[model samples]
Target: MTVFDDGERPRGGGPWPIWGIPLVLSLCGLVMIASLSLRNSMTGGSPYAQIVKQCVFFLSGLVLMFACAFSSLRRFRRWSGLLWFIALLLLVGTLIPGLGVRVGGARRWLDLRLMRFQPLEFLLLAVPLFLADRLDRSRREGFQGFLRPTLMVTLLSILPLLFQPNLGGTILVTLICLMMHVENRGWRYPLMGGAFMVVLFVSLVMIEPYRMRRFLAFWDPWSDPMNKGFQIIQGLVAFCNGRLFGVGIGKGLQEDEYLPAAQTDYIFPAIGEEFGLAGTLFLLSLYAVWTIRAYRIYRRCSNPFLSVLTLGLTMSIIGPMFINIGGVTKLMPLTGIPLPFVSAGGSAMLFMWAKVGILMRINKISLGEGRREREPEGC
Candidate 1:
């Protein structure tokens, strides 16, 4: 049976409802960014500068989303390798002295003159596309089938992320690959891969003093409340102060100075401080609903590539969302990962919208156009 009958198909040529949640969340993000950055903007001599930039990024993201939504999946799959190669080059280029911009001691952005772009964000799409393409071609079974593609992705993608010293990005990319692998290869290969990943992640963390410090902070923020614990402490205070309905937008004290990285990493706390617990729950509900929709689309997709693609893309957004939110709430260590759709980062915003576009396109293909019965050769 088809996933959706003709009458149940989305109207107006797109998955408007699926696309609508991110649109609303992003708009909310703009308001929150404006509120959270008000003090920084004032101190910098332009009260509206940050919000204005965010507006430009949001609009630009919209354009990219529309373009990707209308494009053919076959074309995307065809160019997957090229896109992945370009992404790796960008990742390596960020380590070059004159080309990469260092901010807060980490070199992760390419100096584009107009704006800085994070190369890891490109991996959000590239890794999934490349994996889908590889899996489509591979006919081997068991360890060889999984190991070949897994090793290729790890070397080309995850290695760059770790050297960037972005442990969070490394973890995110690893999880994406794991999810895709599990979907295609089932529990055995993925379980083995997961164990290997865990050991690697812990060893990497132990090797870096700063990462160790962050991990330690997660356990006992009070041990160094004045230093390592400050951000988490302030984040907690933001939630406490927010109480029920929030302190009312722009009225919160955390972003004025107490909370560092308030507009980016800790934006979730800022939302809690201004919009209150109710608003926070509402925001999370939007994410939950959006995720459910993505899963539904995944189930209905008859194409293996599209099915795995959907899973990876969904995790790409949801994984970071949980990490960011959990970090701010002291449920996990601060990973310096931005809250998807709500944080102030141009590259992240653009990639997120593009993913949304791809999901919508997949939904359209699965539901409206009907399913194809063909599966990849070996499977």
Candidate 2:
């Protein structure tokens, strides 16, 4: 089970610290979604609908999570090719007429009878597994060898992602690829990759008038307060009402209609409005702890494949989180991505938990091996 080094392995984490963050966050999300749902009932829809559906997503995601956690890594690796093919098919499927469901002028989903499925979210899981398999196999192939798989994986995912007109997803998938390369090669690749991504970002923004407008809105939302800047302005206002101590849960006005997408995209702002800055900071801190602990697992893993897999998964979680936070706070342009474990979205919730499951599986393997090695030495 030696991955690469002969150094002492760090012990596996206990359930409390590692598991607590997501549980607390998920509970908080459900509560917030439930409270938000109250207003929908007033509008004639069932109040319980959102909460019930969210519960279904959580249960389904847990099933997916356990399935992933229990599966052998070899199985996932073996399925990597199939995962990539499925990812591509789903991505393209979302772009076809009558097949892909269009929302807000962007085609990025398939209308499954039970629930809409977003293929971009699936890429978060599939692309990394694909790269880790490729990169691990290319270990001795030099940079030339590594470069081929990295480029192949990146191009395959990125092209279809952009066609969906999901700027956020395009950026995210690119970052995930860069992150894996950074783990294998060094930080320099990200610098190079960042420059390339920057060019891609700017070109896409410039080509689309809405993106350009949104980009401008990020810098100065007040210039057109009632139109392009409304969401940002409302979100900031929600935070201001929250102050240090929140206005109190279900007491905040933002979710009532002040902030557009208060449920999915701007859930953090709603949280800040109701629970205050303390609540927002608490959520961010949870993510920080999760990231640190997950990274620690990555560092401790001996198998090169598992280590790369660990790093990729960790990056995937944090990237959307910070992006969503930054967008709401106006530090960057809003990308319409839901906050991880906090946003009310079936596809995101499903995959986010699934990623956690895989990481747990890796953690189990790492710790079990450590225990077996230590047992013979009578330590």
| lDDT, candidate 1, 97-175, per-residue tens | 9999888778889999999999988988899888977876788789998787965686569787777778788888888
Off by over 4 Å in 1: 1-14, 370-379
lDDT for each candidate structure:
0.83, 0.83
For model 2, name the residue pairs that clash: 3-302
Model 1's TM-score against the true structure: 0.93
Candidate 2 accuracy as lDDT:
0.83
lDDT tens per residue, model 2, 1-379: 3333357666767634555678788889999999888888678999899999998898888788889776677778888889989989999999998889999878999988778999888889998898988877775454565457886688789898788789898888888887787676666556766897799899999999988998888888899999999999999999999999799988988556888898899999999999998999899889998988887787677667778888888888899998999999988899889999889989999999889888887777767643543322111
- Look at candidate 1 and tell me the lDDT of residue 175: 86
lDDT of 1 at 319: 93
User: What does candidate 2 score on TM?
Assistant: 0.93
TM-scores vs. true structure, each candidate: 0.93, 0.93
